[model samples]
Each structure stands twice: as structure tokens, then as C-alpha cells.
Target: MSLPPPPGTTASGGVPLSRRSLAPDLSRGVMLLVIAIVHAHIFQEMVGGDPQAPGAAFDAATTVFVMTFAEGRGYPMFAALFGYGLARIHLRRVAEGQPWPRVRSLVRRRGRWLVLIGVLHTVLLFFGDIIAVYGLIALMFAGLLHVGDRRLLAHGFTWMALGTLVYAFLNTLPSFTDPAAGGGVLTGSPLADMVTRLFTWPVMTPMLLMTSVFPFAVGVWAARRRVMEEPGLHLGLLRRSAFAGIPVAVLGGLPYGLASAGLWETAGAAETALAWLHLLTGYAGGFGYAALIALLAVRLGDRRGPVVRALAATGQRSMTCYLLQSVGWSVLFAPYALGLASDLSELGSVLVGAAVWLATVVIADVMRRTGARGPAERLLRWGTYREPRSGSATVTAQARSGG
Candidate 1:
């Protein structure tokens, strides 16, 4: 329903395709790759694989690489993008002369739909679904859209500090006591597993929201300035972000990464400190990744290659591709399905994840070439932009205003 707006005009009267920025879409496409790799090992860990267990040299390297670059990295980027998209939608509605109440209603309706869809996704596929959590964030923070820059940035940084502490404590608690103590994976019938997933979703959503608030708030701040939407205008900021954020992220992640990979063992207070460092810098890394991609988009302004096109397409249909990945995980790792989770090594699972991502890229490219909107996007737009009833107050107001 909301495909990249057609060349000159959008049926929805939103931004035109020609006017759309490349950075957000390209970053989303690339972000999914990181997500896939991260989830692959998580799913493997869910079943039987010990991701941090010392193994072959290559596997050790894979664990370190994933811990450093992929894990705790992808989701912040996603949350930021989510915030950016929400701001764009709100801005568009307001610019079209819609009143704040009307726009707020529209956004909240979409958030509710996202929560519903996310619940279904969790029950049907992965237990670690973030969709519903993001929906909740959207609902709670929609009012913050009108806040000043200083307020927005302050909120973001405050949450970052608090969330870092919370996450660090939770992450390192096991290290302090029984690091090996954990629950076993659920290997039940499909219906039973679905029930288990349903139970897990509610608890997971709030925890995720706590960790993601900073990224989401920062994204909103960036969108207010059109940072990603106009990369060239903010080249200096982008360069600084890329140069500083990424290195800090990489360096901060190393101690935890190595320890998790069994290459370096640290416990108690030291491990807790590393966890704090890792998560705090992960936000930086996420921001850096987005800036780097924006810079790349600037460089390839009009000379888009097939790979670039494909990646952009994937980003445009990111929700659809993300759901599709859940399906892949269901097939590949679910105990009731192939049950490959127990069989594959961490490195091996990552390779499989890479393959899954490539497959989605090809699929997304095909959808783009066919001039098709993503199914999930279509559904969301259909729900969010529904027509008012003939006799409704909104319709009456519009008719009176000659809209």
C-alpha cells in the first residue's frame, strides 16, 4: 500500500519516490544482515549449542567476530530506524495540515496494530520478537515528537545511562554466581511451543523496551534534524560519528567479546564492568553503522548498482523481510521443525544465517523489480490509513472544509 512512492506522485500523497532518501533504506537492508547473523547463534543457543564454548580456531574467531560486531549491535540500529520512520510519518501527516489529535490517533492505531502483529509473529515463529516492544515504544513516545531538541537529547542520554547500568547488571549476574545455570530449550509439540512463546512475549517486550529507548529517542532527535534523510547536509556529523563511535564500540566490545568466546576469562566485578562497557559502546556502534551507511549512500548518489539497489529494496520492505527471516528460523532451528539448532556449531549456524540473508535479498530484489509492495507494509498501511465512514465526524469535518 505504501510502496516507495511512485516517481512523480504517491497515491497516498506521501513523499515521492524521487524525493526519498537512500540512507535509511540502505542502512535497514544492511542492518538485517547483522540481525540474521545475531539471531542464528541465539537460536542455536536456544536449542543446545554453546556459543561461547571454546572450540576450533575458526569457530573461536567466529564467536569473537559475532560478539564484537553483530550481537547487541543490530537491534539499536533497528530501534533508531523505527523512531525515524515514526517521526517521518508524524511529520508528513502534520505537514498535510492534519491536526495533532488526528495524527496522534493515526499513530496510536498503527502502534496497536504493530503490537497485534508482533504477538502473532511471536506465537508463530521466534520467541524473541521485538516488533511488539517497538509498537509499545511508539505508543508511549508519540507525544514526545513535539518536544524540543534539548529535551529529546537529554531524555535519550539519560535513558542510555540508566539502561546501560540495568543491562550490565542483568548480563553479568550469571557470571557472578552460576554462569552455567540456565533453563533448557522447549522441545514440545507445535501447539505447546506456541503457548510457551505466547507466555514469553509479554515479559520480553518491556525488557527490550528498556534497552531500546535510547536508540529510539536518538533516532527521533536525528529525524527532527533530517540527519539521515539529508546526509550531505550533515557530512561533518556523519564523519565524526563514524570515526569516533565505531572505534569506541569495537574497543569496548573486545573484553566482553573475548571473555564470552572463552578466549579470555573474567568473572565477578570485572565481567560486570565489561558488560557495561560493551552495551554502552554498542549504542555508539549502532549509530556509527548508520552514519557509515549514510556516507556510502552519499557517495553512490545516482550511480546505484544492482547490489545497492537490492539492499535498498530490502530496506524498503524491511518488515516483510524481517518476518520472512522468522519463518526461516522456524524452519531451520525450531525443535519441532528441522531441529538443526542442536546439530550446527555456532560458526556453522552463522554461515547458514548468511545464506538465509542472501536468499531474502534476492527475494526482496525480485519484489522490487515486480513493482510489488511488501505484504506486511501493505497490511500496515491499509490498517493505518483506513478511510473514515461517510457519516463520521472526521468525514463531516473534511466535507465542511472542502477537503
Candidate 2:
């Protein structure tokens, strides 16, 4: 069997497996489940559909649960975690005595690779790829690593307000509000669909980036403060966040959820207002989820139960597992494949999504047992941390000329 990575560093330039903080990984693992549940409904008109449509009571309950707990919340959590990880990497490298310029280069290289991988993922599998959006954010904001705490917070809240406004407006649009305009359907040949995805990716990536900036910024600030890394030290803050944020999110989402479940009828202006409330509160819910998970992680420390281990393993290989989820979705729902998009109800899709996530968790745990790094993560590490031969060569030549 392979051995654990060296102290302080893993192959991916992240914390070593043995040294990783529990909260971030645990939160990521659980957040993937939330993301899966949210994405499951995109192929159907879950919340945007008719308010008077017939459905089972169970399905309606599930719809309410998903809307109030899952929908717009997952992405913000992931975005925050992404920012946290980015800052964590930079901090660790600096602590390890790496130069700032070199760390910047590494960040940029990883971002570029992520963009490429995300584009390919969109073209080949799912259309709603987030990897590229995060990658683009990394590229644009690498310099923020040096910014002060006040500036970082300022930028984060500012972007948060702007992002919420834009997202709220977009959700109020015809395409989102109209049931017929939503849901995924890949018609025609595989190649033809791929071409369509290629076109769609460019337009989608920037829009996603806009929505995510606030969470990402907040994540960076949180990381700088070492919030997730040492949750024990910040119990009061975590508790407050969890207590306040979640209730607001749930209450804000109720109207939309009830309407979507056909339990409450709503029209144009009311629906639009509900959408705004849901999206805005979603950000708070996302942070609350993360904070709550971190608290759990702190409570579960050193215990490392089987379930926790499996979930953390999944989080470590999140990028790979996230892509795998897309593959599963394509096979199950695409018109060229199983074509279950219209056949399956929202509840059914959610079950499938949960199963898919569970499968990845098992796979990830097995890999963890063998001490194997995730394939995508390994590739990213290779690209981001490779030696710069040209720069070294130039240095050597200058030395010779000086001599």
C-alpha cells in the first residue's frame, strides 16, 4: 500500500492527508450532497413550474425540503469553500518559505488548468460546469492574497450585494419563471450536442462567476482568519451564524417552496418577490451550513467514524467525484442515453442523485485506503507545481554572464 504524503504538503499542494483540518473536508463532503440534490431538479421544472399542478404529498414535502434547504444554497457554500482552500494554499506555501511570486504563478497555473478541464467537462458531459467559473475567479483575484482584512471584507460584501441583485433579477426573468423554458434535454447526435455545449459554456461561465464572487470573497476572508481550520477557537461565531442564517434561509424559501409544491398559488409579482427572497437568503444558508458542519467536525474530532471517514474521503476527491456525477447524470437523463429526464419525477431524480453521491463516497474511501490521490487532483498538482525550467535556465545564464 502507498504511504501518506509528507508532512505539511500533499501531492496537490494542499494540506497532507494526515494533517488536514476536519471541518473543511467534512463540510465539502456534505455540501456535495446538497449540490447533487439541487442539480437533480434542473432537468425538471421543480420550483419554476405551475403552482396548481398535481403531485403526491410526499413529493410536495420533498419539494419544500429541497427549496428551503438545498436549492440556491449549495453553490454559495462551495464557492466559499473554494475561496477558503485557495487562501489556505497560499498561506501554507508562504509559511513553507515559498516566494510570493512563485505562489502567484502556481495559483494562476492551477486556475488555467481548471478552466480547461471545466470546458472539456461541459462539452463532454454536463452543461452546468462550475469548475471554470472558480478557475476564472482564481485568475482574476490571485493578487487579493496580499490585500488587508478590511479591504477583503469590503470587497466581499460589496460583491455579495451586487451578485445577489444580479441573481435575483435573473431568477425573475422569463426563462427561469417559465416552466417550459427550464430543464435539460440533449437532443440530436452526440457530436451535435457537444457543439451546443461548447457554445453554451462561454455564456454560462461568466454568469456563474458573477453569482459566486461574494461567497468566494467571504471564503477567502474566512480562511485568512483561520475560521474553518480552528473552529474550536471561534465557537461563538459559528453558533451565531448557524442559528441566525439557517432560519432566515428557510423562512425566505417557504413561499417559493410552497408554490412549487402546488400548496400555495402565486402570480408574476409575488413569484418574482419570492425568488428574490430565496436567492438572497440562500447565501446566508450556505454560510450557516458550512459553519454548522465545522462545529460538527470539531465535536467529532479524533473519533473518525466510518461514515465520517467516507464523507471526508469524498471531499478530498471532490473535483473527480463532481465530474463523475456529471457522467452519471448524462447516462441517466440525456436523450441519447437513458432519457429519464421527463420520465423521472423530482423525487426520483433526487434519489438517483443521492445514490450517485453515495457511490462516489465509497469509491473515494477505497482510494483513501490505498493512499491514492484523486486523478484530477494529481493532474492539477503536476501542472501547478512543476519546476520552471525556462526561468531556471535564464537565471543560470545570467549567473554565467556575470561571472
Candidate 3:
């Protein structure tokens, strides 16, 4: 597989190098879209009416399916891609003769922006904002970037293990201290929960930060090694990573899922051990997810097929689409809004998510036709360049210089 030029670099005598505007971005967008569906369902399940007093089995079942497929997997994909994008940016800067130190400043700026976005998302939109965590994790990327690939991979696994141990130990604590402390579905006023999550849930922020950093670090390692850019060199490693990741994900996910639903009641030493095991497995699974997806993107990207193109479009504008989902769902489901939150089942929510994804596709398609970038992308470009709007000629020239 051929590696595309660094994000902002030109090819040869600069006939306006293709922006590697291909599959990965689109695939990531689809992942985010699916994630929104799960988020919507979860919000409803928690706050929509009482599940115990439910008059809706269908809704409940839909919720189960989403929980099964999306909860464990979706964010990992996003995290991995975040890493990949970070590496790409780093490479582009290096190609432009910028020192790597600039990455620190960029990460800091981006992290601050991410934290702001995440805070707003939690307060006004969704409480499970990953951006804030991502922002925090971005700080570590600069340090991690300097590490050799072997060390980076080793450190990634070490953190995964340590994080799991910490998580599992905490999980088993209540079992020892107060076994009767029932795990209730997290619900209540969004405002109340938001406050609690921010202030009381000590694990929330750290977990978010870990989720973002682990995958991102891996992405940096992979990019430095040119793994995605030249897949053939790493196919063996990729395959092994996938093989190891799948079973680990299953083992980790099973107990965690059961624990979520109140299946495990006892808090023995064994349970503590298993809890740590689950945590490690989950992180491994996330890495596996990243490797598998990156491999797929590299292998299939060159074809530029229709599906690939569509996915690429979606990925390119993921930030816009992600925010759009939040806005759309809020209008559709909020108690003060459309109030569909109480109306749809989990399964129905998934369908609604599909509908939302389709809507984004349509919008993306329309924008592409008009030679338009997503609004968020456009704004980011403006911020990056500190420039006014320009015609395609100017864009082509910019492209020639590797923007």
C-alpha cells in the first residue's frame, strides 16, 4: 500500500497534490454517527421515563442492542483515529520545516479548545463529552512523541494495564465496603447529573483522558513508523494485534457489561482480580480496534470507490457532523423540546440514529457538490491561516504548499 504525502505537503512539481481525501475520515465519521445513536438511546434510557415502570419493551430491547455493539467499540475507534490524525499533523509540520516543539504549542491550544467544547457539550448537550478528556490527553502526546516506537508500544500497554488495575480496584471497593450499595441507572435532571459527574465522579475525567491518550499515543507511534502509509511493512504486526485484541475485548467487555446491569453482586478478591483483568482487556481491545481499522483504511483507501468516497467525506467533516448530531438530537428528544426521549425505544433510537446519519450524508453530499467544506472545517482553516476566503485558485495554491 502506498502512503499519501504528509497532510500539508505537495507532490512532485505541485500539480496540486490530492489531499489524501479518501476513506479514513469518512469511516471515522460513520463511526461517530453510529456513536451518536448510542448516546441518544442512552440518554433516553437514563432520563426518559423510568425503565422499571416502563410501558415499552421495544424501547428497552433497542437500548440493549446499542449497549451491546456501540458502547465498548465506538469511542475506541474515535480515539485511535485521533491518534492517527495527530501523527499526520505532526508529519505535515515537520515537512514544512517546523520544529517538533511547535507540536506542544499546537496540542496545548487544541487541548484548551477541546476542553472548552467538552465543557459546553456536557453542560448544554451531552454529559459524556470525550473532547475534554481528549484535550487533556493531547498534552501528553508531545512527550510520548519523542519515544521510540518500541518504547511507545510498551508504554501504551503498561498504561492500559495500570489503568485497568486502578479501575478494577475501585470497582471492587464498594463490594467490600458496602455490597448492598445498589447500582442504579444514572438518571435525574441533566443539570444535576452533570454537576455530579464533574465534581463527584473522580474516575470520569481520568478515564476520558486515558481513552484519548492511549490510542493517540499508538497512532503517533504507528505514523512515525509509517505503518498506515505503508501497510505492507506492518501487515504481520497488524494481524497479530487484531488477533490478540478481539478475545481481550470480549473478555473485558463481558464482565463490564454484566457489572453495568447488576449481574455481579459479590466483591471478593477474585472479583477484584477480574475487574482489573476486564480493564486491561478493554484497553487492549481498543488498541486492537485501532489497528484493525487503520489496516482496513490503508488497504481499501486506494480504490477510491463510491462507498469509500462517501465515508471519506463524512470523516473530513466529522467535527461538524458530531455537533450536528447533538443539536439534532437535542431538538428531537429533550424534555422541553420534541420529547422523543420518552417516546423511542433503544432500537427505535438506533433507527433514528440511522436517519440522522443519512441526513448528514445528504448534507455532506450537497456541500461537496458546491465545493464547500463543512462549516467547522472552514472555520478551522480560517483559524489556522488567519486569512479571508479565497477562490479555488488560491486554495489550489495553498494546496501546492501543502495546506
- Model 3 residue runs over 4 Å out of place are 1-8, 11-18, 21-23, 50-68, 167-203, 262-279, 290-301, 384-402
Global CA lDDT of candidate 1, please? 0.80
By summed lDDT, the worst window of 10 consecutive residues in model 3 runs over 176-185
- Give Cα-based local distance difference scores for all models: 0.80, 0.78, 0.60
What's each prediction's TM-score? 0.89, 0.88, 0.76
Q: Write the per-residue lDDT of candidate 3 for residues 352-385, one digit (tens) a residue.
A: 7778877887677666667667876564444333
lDDT of 1 by residue, 272-295 (tens): 888888888999999999999999
Candidate 2 lDDT for residue 126: 79
Residue pair clashes in candidate 2: none
Candidate 2 C-alpha lDDT tens digits along 283-343: 8899999999999988997899899998998888899889888888788777778876666
Candidate 1: 10-residue stretch with minimal lDDT = 1-10
Whole-structure CA lDDT of model 3:
0.60
Rank the candidate models, highest lDDT first: 1, 2, 3
